[model samples]
Target: MLNAAETRCDALIVLADVDHVIHVPLPNFTFQRSIDLQGILKSFLRKALVERTGQIERWDRGTWESFLSPLWKCVVEPVMDALAFSTPGDLSRIFWCPTGPFVFLPIHAAGLYDTKYSAPGHKVFDFVVSSYVPTLSILAPSRNIYVAHNDDFRLLAVRQPPTDGRRLSRLPGVHTELKHIKEVITNSGSACATFLEPSVGTVEEVLGLMNEADWVHFACHGIQDAKNPIDSGLCLANERRLKISDIIGLSRSRGGLAFLSACQTATGDEGLSDEAIHIAAGMLFAGYAGVIGTMWSISDTLAPIVARDMYEHLFRNGTRPDYREAAWALHEAIGRVRESGEVSFNEWVPFIHVGL
Candidate 1:
C-alpha cells in the first residue's frame, strides 16, 4: 500500500499503485461446529449456485437474506472490526480479493438486508466503495491508468444479439441500454460510438476499436470454458468470439474502464478458482483501471436499467466520464437496485466491480 494524495475536493484520488489490506479470517477465531471454514465455503457456493438457487430467487425473507446474514456475521463483519472500520464511511474505497471457493461468495453484498433487528450500518457497502481483485499481484502492475486531460473520453460500446445458428439467449434490453449509454456520453461531450449485431460487431473490429478508445463496454452473452480458460470469451457478431487470449494481448496506455454486462464475466473456473482466470480479470490485465462484471447470470430486462443509472452517475452532465469514479458509481447503482424492492436477490447480487 502507498500513501494517496487528496484532490482539491478533498476526495482521495485512486492511484495506479496498489494500496490494500488482506485478512484471512479463518485463523482469527475458533469454530464451535465440527465443520471447518473450508467446508463451510464449499457448501456456501454449492448451495447458492447449484443446490438451493431457486429458493434464493423465489423463497420468503428467510431464504432471501440467508447468505448475506451469515456472511456478515462470520466473514466480512469480523474483517471490518479487525481493521477498526467501526462506522459508516470510515474507508472511502476498498477492494476484495477472494481466493478459492470464496471467489463465488458475494463479499460486497454481505450484510443482513431483510432482518428487522440489523443495524443501519451493518452492510459492507455502507462503509466504503467496494471493488475486487483476484489477487494482489494482479493489480500490482500498470493498471488504474487514466486518460490525459487533453484527450477526449472515447468509448467503444457494443451490443451483441444472438448470431445465426447459435442458440444463445438474446438480451432485448441492450438496444435501450446502448441508446441510454450513448445519450449520457454525448451529453458529457464525449464519444460513445456503438456497434450492434449485423454491423461491425466482429472480433477484429472490436479489438481495433478497443485499442483506440479510452473506455470499452460489452452487452452480450458470455461463454466460460472451464476446460480451457483461454477459450472463455464474449459472443460477437458473425460467429466470431473475443477470447480471453485476445484480451490479454491488449495493453493500452489509454485504458480506463470496461463495463461487461454479460453473464459470468467474473466467474473463474471451478477447478482453478485460486488462479482467478476470468474475463473481468483479463480486462484488468489488459490495462483497464476499473472493470464491472457479474459473478453469475443477470436478468436480461434489468440490465439496461442498471447500465443507465451507472453511466448517469459517472457522467452527471460533466465534460467527461471520470474513470476514477467507476467503483463509486457502481456502488451507487447497485444500491438503487437493491433498495428498489422490485428485484429478486439474484437480480442484484451478481453485479460486481473489479480493480481500482
Candidate 2:
C-alpha cells in the first residue's frame, strides 16, 4: 500500500476537533451535535478519500469500512440518515471540512484561544471570504488570496435578538462604540478598497467592484439554512439570498480579499458544523487564498465599527501580532468608547473569529 504522503492525491480530508467539539449550538437552533460530526464525514470525508486513494491504492472496502465503521455508526451514518429526511433544499445547509489531499482546517471551536493542533497540515496558499469580516489573518497566517462573495450580517451589526450573558461578554458596546472605531480606519486610508452595496445588487456588480482591489469588504446580512448548511446565503436588501454558487463563480474569475460583514457569513448555523467552515469552506474550496468569518450573532449597529477598526489595524500593522492581539485591538477600541461614556460597557464583545 502506498504511504499517506507518498500517494499523490487529487484531494484531502481534514478532521477538525479530533480532540472534541462542543457540537451544541447556543440555543434556538435545530442542528444536533451527534449529527454534525456524522454529516461531516459522510458529506466530505468519503468523497475526498476516494478521490485521493482512487488513483493509486485499490481501496479495501472491508478495511476502509472497518476503519470508518466506528465513526459511521457512532457518527457518520446517523447524521446522514437524519439529513436524508431533510427536503431537497435542506441538505444544502449541511457542511463539512473535507480531508485528504485537499487541506483540512479543523479549529477547536471551544478552544480557539488555547494552543492546540488546530492549524492545517499543509502550507496555505490563499485567503477567501464572503464579506468584509475581521480576524482572518489572526486565525491563520498561511492564506494570501482572500475572496468575498456577498455580505455577512455578523460583519455589519454587533448584536441580534436573543442576546444572553455570553453574547454580552464578548461585545459590550457594539453599536455606537463600534461605529467610532470604523471612523478611524476609513479616514486613515488603511483600506486598499471598500465596497458598499446600495440596497440591491448582483453577483456581477460584486465581481466588478471586487476587481478593483486586493481586499474586498461588504457590509451586509447573511442568511443561514440551519438544516441545509450549504443552502445558507447572503441576505441582499432586494430580499434575495446570495448562494455559494454565486461566490464560486466570482472566485473563478478573480482573486484577492473577500470580507463578509453579514450575519452567519462565516459561522455555520446551529446543528451544523462548527468553526464557520460551511461558508468560509466554500470560499476556500472555490480557490480563494483565505477567508475570515464570525462565530455567533452580532449587534447590527456595532459590527461595522469593529470591522473597520480591525481592518485598519491589520492593513497598517500587518497580520502578525497573534490572534489575541487582533481581538484586543478591537476590544480596546470598543473599551475607549465606553470610557468616554458615549455608551455603557455592557454592550461589547459579540463578534468572534469564525475562520482562517
Question: What is the TM-score of each predicted model, taking all chains together?
Answer: 0.83, 0.43
Query: Could you tell me which residue pairs clash in candidate 1?
Result: none
Candidate 2 lDDT (Cα, whole model)? 0.37
Instruction: Give lDDT tens digits, candidate 2, residues 276-312.
Output: 3356556655544444444334454455565666656
* Candidate 2 similarity to native, TM-score: 0.43
lDDT of each: 0.71, 0.37
Candidate with best lDDT = 1
Q: Candidate 2: which stretches are off by over 4 Å?
A: 1-186, 189-194, 252-256, 269-277, 317-350, 354-356
